[model samples]
Structure formats: C-alpha cells, structure tokens
Target chain A: MTIEGQGAVPGLTARIFAGHAGPIAVVVLAIVVIWYAGAVYMNAPRQMDVFKRANADWGAVDLIEGTWAQDRPILPAPHQILAELKKTIIDQKVTSKRSLVFHTWVTLSSTLLGFATGAVLGIVLAVGIVHVGTLEKSLMPWIISSQTIPILAIAPMVVVVLGAIGLKGLVPKALISTYLCFFPVTIGMVKGLRSPDPLQMDLMSTYSASPWQTFWKLRWPASLPFLFTSLKVAVAISLVGAIVGELPTGAQGGLGARLLAGSYYGQTIQIWSALFTAAALAAAMVVLVGVVERVVVRAMGGRP
Target chain B: MTPSPVQSGPAGSDGDSVVRAHGLTLSFQTADGPVHALSDIDLEIGRGEFVSLIGPSGCGKTTLLRAIADLEQPTGGNLSVNGVPAHEARLARGYGYVFQAPALYPWRTIERNVTLPLEIMGMAAGARREKARDYLELVNLSGFEKKFPWQLSGGMQQRASIARALCFDPDLLLMDEPFGALDEIVRDHLNEQLLQLWAKTQKTVVFVTHSIPEAVFLSTKIVVMSPRPGRIIDVIEADFPRERSLDIRETPEFLEVAHRVREGLRAGHSYDD
Candidate 1:
C-alpha cells in the first residue's frame, strides 16, 4: 500500500508548516489575545473610578478606550510596552544610559563573563570528581548543598560583602551570576563525564590506555552532549543572576537598574518593557547556546 | 610454581602457548553472596590458534576472555600471557580486544578510531595515519576512513572495530561475541571474513560465542563450557587447513566435528537442570 501523504505536494507543505511554525504562531496569537483582555479587565475599574469622581457620563466604548491608553495603569497593554521598547531601544542613542541597549550590554557583559567562569569552574570540578574518588566523596555533598540556599537570599549578601572588600559594579554582579550558574554546570558535567559505556571503558583497559588518554579519547567527547545541555541552563540562569545582583546594589546601569527605577516611579509601562526585554534576552542567549551545541555535537559525529 | 607438564589439554600445543591459565577462578561479591563467575578454568591458547568458546547463557566464556585481557581480577590461580602475568601483558599492550559491540568513538572518523591505541601508545602521527590506512584497507573500509561510525551499518561498524583492534599489530586478539548482534546473513558473512582475517594475520585469537555453527565454522578448537560456576567441560579440535572456505561446513569431517561439539555442549548442559 502507498503512503497517503507521500506524493501530495500541497499536503506536504501544509504538514511541514503545521508541524512546528503553525503551533508557535497560534500560541503567540492566543497569548496576545489573552494579554489584551487582561489589560482591559485590570485597568477598567480604575478608569471607571476616575470617571465617577469627575461626574463624567462615559459609555462602555469610552471606558474601554480610556483603560487601554492609560498613562499609569496597573497593567500596561502590549502596544504600550512595544512603544516603550521602540523609544528606548531604537530612538535613543545606544550610549545613553536611558537606552535599553545600553542596559542590555551592561547585563550581557556580566552574563557572558559569569557563564564562562562558571562553565570552566564546573568542568574542572567535574573532572576532579570523576577522576579522584576522594574528591567525589568529599566535594559532591558540598556542591549539592551549595544550590539549596536561594540565590536571591545570597545575592544581596554577596554584593554587600564583596562591596566591603572594594569590589563593585560588574565583578560583584558577575560573581552572583557565577554562583547561580555554576550549580547546573557542575551537576550536568558530573553526569556527562560519567556517561561512557562500561564496554568502552573495558576496551580502553584492553589497550592499556592511561587515565589521561581514556579521558581525552573517550570520556570528554562522549560528555559533550551533556555539557551543552547544562550550558543552556547555565547561560539563562546567569542572566537572571545578573539582573538580581543589580537589584540589591541599586546599580546606575543595566536592566535590573531599569526595573528598579521603573518600580520607584510607578512607571508600569517601563517595568513591563524591561521585563519583556529581559525575557527576550534570555531566549536569545539560550538559542545561541543551542546553536553552538548543534555545531559541536554534529562535528563529533552525532546526528544533525 | 611453574605449570605441570599437563599434556592432557585438549588444544595444547608443543609448549608455545600464548595464553596459559591453570586452575583460574573468579568470583564477584554481590549483595546476596559471592557469585562464582569462573571456577577452575584451565586453558592454554597456542600461537596463531583460532579458538572459540561456546556455551549457553551465564557461561563465563566472556569472563575468561576478559581475564586473559586483564580486564578481570581472578581470585585465585595462575594466568600468564606472553610469558608474563596478565597485568604485565596488558601494560605491555600485548593484545587487542574486540567487544560484543563495535565500541567505536563516535567523535572520531573511522581512521582516527582505528588509530586510537596507536595514539595512546604515543606513536608518531605519520606512522599512525599510515597504519590506519593499511588496516582500513585490509578491512575494505579505505574510502570510508573520513566517515563517522554512525554513518556505517552494524556490520560495517563491527568490521571497523576489528580494524581498530588489528591496527596496533598485537600478537593476540580477544573477541567477545563480536558478531552476536548482527543478523544471520551478516553474521555468516562476518564469520567468513573473520576466518580469512585469522588466516592472513596469523594472530592467536580467543573468541567467545554461544552459536554452535559459529564455533564449528571458524575455530581450530571449540571450547564447550557450562554456566553457574562457569566451568569448561570439553574441548574439541577441528584441524581444517588454513585456506579452507565455508563449503567445508558441509563435508563429513566438518559435520563430524560439529556433531562432537554439539555432543559436548549437550553433555555440559545436562548438569544445568
């Protein structure tokens, strides 16, 4: 029997499109619809209250319109945040502290620095734990317990203590990111480094391969998939760490400072814009990591 | 003490055994109790001999091969390879082993995979590449050198593993059911290739398998073993000429040897129930 969809050209196109892009588009559309509805629902009561105090005769259309375009509503509409984004990210000079691009760069620098440092630290620890039985037994429990303490609880303390030692700005923020990001890397790398099959290990023994050779030839390459998976999580968490670090210090630059400033001034639109920008930034960084993982894994003979 | 002059070994040669084990025993300490993997295993593999160990499940054929390769530690008994203890033999890289699976590193090209042992031994880059090329060609995988392991079929992967095991020019090759996972056609084809490879290389091989015909077809000596203490019960010799083809399996002499091997296996298996 012939496959039903094999030779149907239009059906193939539709199926391919529907397989991925279609679901994403539908989900996005649904989110926007819900968001607009929520914006109207949350903002209308305040607008009606204002109208009642002014003894104004307003219809439902006027109330809905008024609520949607409020200057300081509790929840900003999607278009309002988009307008804010365009103003800060596009209209302003990137060098200006007010520009979101400037803030993003500040946050991004710390994220990359923290991610790099954390990844290196994690891999070194993993290697130690895998190769050294004493380290695995001694350091593993400590490493696991390190993540149990909340990053938020520790972020402020880390900032304050590091500040006392004359460390400020990017280094302190990055250190916080390092703390948040290192756990995943350490955990993932441990699993990855131990991922080689018993038979492969036996083969190495047959060849009289040294621990160093076995590591370089077999364990490292095999662990790459696990390392990359951890890297994605680490990078995203790094961004969060940077943002959180900025909060306690009340830093003069970066997305976290923007969020703080917006909150102090009751600029709901600004807050919403900064929050969305942070989200988009996280998504972009994760995708970037995913791209690198694909390249490395494929080069290592994994299926594309 | 040195091994006694035990001429009763079914496949013993004229004092040139590459692998010699006397009263070898290995047991594992599991949660329940000590499990005897191999008990009182006495084996001697002569130079350039192709020996097959055949047994049912739980048999210590693979363990015996591993013990010879120094991958297992025997609780008792004396075992030697290349006139030295098994550990020393391993440290000298005296043998190459092919596992049940291909075990090729996915990251490396087929040539690089073949050169793994050479690289570990710190061979010169040029020599390693040249040797890889020669062996890949020997395995009929020359053009596929730059390709990865996953790019090949299961049969091709196993052949590449064989090339890897041979590229180091070891005098002994220990194979653990190398073709057990392949389909019947592929297994038959591989068996033929392996026999030809053995004839060409003249390396002593100790192969582990459970297939009766496979043991009969490729082995100069067939070792029939039993499980649950995993002891060898019988050894049968089939002294076919080196250049003989697969057609020999149909001959009366071949069938007679096969029949004997089957009988030995049956005799050993009777104790299982």
Candidate 2:
C-alpha cells in the first residue's frame, strides 16, 4: 500500500517532527553557541598565561608557535578534548592494553553483567510480591528504604569486604550495578502485574482459568509497557553503580578509574572525555532496551 | 417444595425440554444480611422456545440466568438442563450465555472473540474459523472481523458478543438484557435480527429483558418476576404468531400480550409491596 493510503505515515512523521526535531535542534544550537562563547572567554586569559610561561621556560614553540594548544592546568577547551578523542581512537592504539577503549570495555562488561543480574532478580522478586500479599506489604517498604543508603558510602565498604576475601576485578562492580539496577525493575513490575483491569480478571474467572493461567495470559502481557519503562531506569542506574564500584577499588582501568586519575593529576580534559563516554554508554544501553521492547511487543501483536 | 404450574401444552414429538428448574432459591450474603435474590422459582423451557424473563432492575432475572448457566449456585432447590444438573450439562453440553453488558475481550479481535468458546471446546482450527465467519455474518458484522473490540461502537460490540455466544451452536442460549443499552431504532433492528437468528438456529433461548414490547415480540413465553425477595408473579403465554416482525407491535394480538405482561409486572410489584 502507498504510505499515505496506510493512514499512519503522516501522523507518525508529524509526531516525530513535533516531539523530537524541534527540541533536538534547539539543544544542539544552544550547546554549540555556549561552548564557543565559553571557549573564547576562557582561552583569552589561558592563552596569555601560556605565552608568558612559554617565553620564560623554553622558547616560542610554547608561546607563538602552538602556544594556544599547550597550556591548560584544568578545564581544557572543547577542541583539546576532541583532539585527544581522535588521537586515542585513531592514531593511538586505544583497543590495545594501554588505551582508554580497553578500560571502557572493562567497565561496560561489568555494567552489563550487573544490570542483567539485577533485572532478573528484581523481576523475580516483583512476581513473588505480586503473587504473595504478605511479601508485597512487608518487603516493598524495605526495598524502598534500601535505595536511601548512598552507593558512594557503601562502595568503600563493599570493595574492602570483597578485597579482604580476595574477590576483586568485575564482581564488586557488577554487584553494585545490580544493587542500583534492581529497585526500579521491582517497582515497575509490581505495578505492571497489578495492571490488569477488573473486567479482564473477571473474564478469566468466568473461564474457570487458574491463577497461573491468568498470570501467563493476562498479567504478563499487561506488564510489558511497565517492564520496558523500568528497564530504561535500571540501565542508567546500573551505569551509576558500575562507576561507583570503580571509585574505591583503586582500579587502573575503566572510565571511573580514568576519571579518578584525571582528577588527581588535574587532567580535566581526560575527566570530561570519560564522563562523556559514560553518558554515551548509558544512552546506548537505554536505546538497546527500547529496541528490545519494540521487537517483543511487535511479536506479541502490538502495533509499536 | 411447591411444584411449578403445569405448562398446559401438547408435548412436542422430540420430548426435549431444554431447561427445567424446581423450587430454585438463590441468596447472596450481603454485608447487611442474607439477601434473597430469587425464591421458589420454578421454570421449564422447551426446545426451540424463546422465553423472556421480564422484571425490574433488581428482580433477580439475571441471577436466575447465571444460575442456569452454572455461573452461580442456587441456595436451595434443584435445577436441571437436558436431563442433567446445570453444572454437568454446562460441562458436557455447553450453553451460550450473554451477560447484560457486551463482555468482549478488548485484546482480542472480533473474529477471535467469536471463536473463543470454540477454542475452549477444543474444536478443530478449520471448523472454528468457518463457524466464526458464519456467526459474524449472522450478526451482520461480516467486514469487521479483524477490528479490535474498542474500535467498534456499542451496538457493534453487542452484536459481536451475540455472535460469540452463538459460535458454538449450543442448544440453549441464555441472554441477560442483551439489547437493553441500545437505542430504540437499534433495538428494533436487533430484535428482528435476533428473531431471524432464532428461526434459523431453532435453539432454546431464555432471554432476560425489561421492555414489554420486547418480551411480547420475541418470546413464546414471558415469565414476569417480582422484586424484594424475588419470585415469579405471572407467566404469560404469548399467542402471537411464530413468524413475527417489527410490524407485529402494531397488531392487536401483540398489544394484548404486551398489556398482559405490563399488568403482570404491576401486580408483581403491588403483591411484593
């Protein structure tokens, strides 16, 4: 069928334009403008200081020759970070042992493992809570309370405890991610399991269907939207947990370690680059969940 | 228990009474106390008969149908269908039951909704498809099979529900105010369609409705029920011809039966009060 004849294409296109295009354009424009303005303002003083320092120290290579490139103690310019990103990704062997890519891969692995573990545990717990009223009434409040304890404060203890037992590398990081990722999944699943309408439940009862059948046919399908929503939240939290886990372990790899080293040595450009990488990773994880949601719901005969 | 009044009719050659209830009493445990929904109710419906249980809102007509459908248990007395207990009859010989509202599942397509009972009965896939198609055509919803329930209008949904009920070709059909929510024009059209359906299927139908003309137009027998502690007050045998039309409402014979049903209703209320 022709796209217009299908009765959905125009509306879909309009929605994309209205909801996404405008905000994205505006945000992109604002960020570019702000970055350039900040670059000019910050670089003026830094360039003068660099010129002075280079003239005193070595020669004009630091002052008049590539002097603008040479001198920030912290808060490096956008161009500097971009140059570093290109050098690390292309010129330098980033995928090798010494590169940032290897560390990023390590962090990504722990984050994914932790997220999967947490999501499965959370979903199981949610199913149990939904089926058992006592668990729902008693355990829900405690789960909520568990989130209040800061991961930053707990990370050191976790690292120490695991280290004492000679458990290191990815386990502690994955556990932290699991801890952060599970809460949203539990809450979302509980809401989803309870989402079936009274009439739908009554229909199942009229069929003399067992509770298990009802759950399989009705409750599970109804929970899909909520499950995906929780997945998005859990993925972001999983990244946070992985980052926190890296903080106390004195780990030499991963974005968290890069962030720590950059801060300690006053390499602001490295820190910002790592932060951006983490943000991109989290975005990628959420996008992956969105893709899975689309595939699943479509398989279940829903119009995604 | 008091015996039901004699049916006073020549026995049909087939000798199949589709439904028979003896001294049926139904009570629900409400917060206040035990509420007698139905009491000492005795009814018998013959094969190919169309009967309407006409009563006020709370007169337990729907409750009686539910009991007959094995969806509810009678507090006392025996209810049988086709020579067996209602529950057993329901399991062995399935009965089509249409609730007051169109209880079509929202998630299912109209075709799937019609085939639900067939699926439940474990009918073969090919036969189920053919039967669903036939019933959708019966309800004049031939082109809308693939549409979801929410996409249809209320009248269309009700039609789909009726189609679903008839999909299994059950000998007995119990409808609870099937068209009470429709507009007058739609109700008249549906009544004609329903009579046509009855003519074709020749199934025993026990329908619950409050409309006097509806009961008079559709039913071979009108069981007028009373409220409070609900009980049958009158049973009117409609003398209207078998092949009825919407124009039957203008006839004197139809008017006489309508008058009788109304009087039965009034007398039922007065007797209760």
Best TM-score among the predictions, by candidate number: 1
* True lDDT of residue B164, candidate 1: 92
Model 1 over residues A1-304: C-alpha lDDT tens digits? 9787676657655875767888787899999999988988999999999999999999988988888899998988899999999999999999999899999999999989999999999999999999999998999899989889988899999999999999999999999899888889888988988999998898889888888888988889888899999999999999999999999989999999999999999999999999999999999999999999888887788876
Best candidate per lDDT, number? 1
lDDT tens per residue, model 2, A96-164? 745777878889999999999999999999999999989988998899998999889998898889989
The DockQ of each candidate is 0.73, 0.19
Highest DockQ model number: 1
Superposed Cα deviation of residue B115, candidate 1 (Å): 1.4
Q: Evaluated on chain B only, what is the TM-score of candidate 2?
A: 0.93
Interface RMSDs of the predictions, in order, are 0.9, 3.6
Report, for every candidate in turn, its global Cα lDDT versus the true structure. 0.89, 0.81
Candidate 1 docking quality: incorrect, acceptable, medium or high? medium
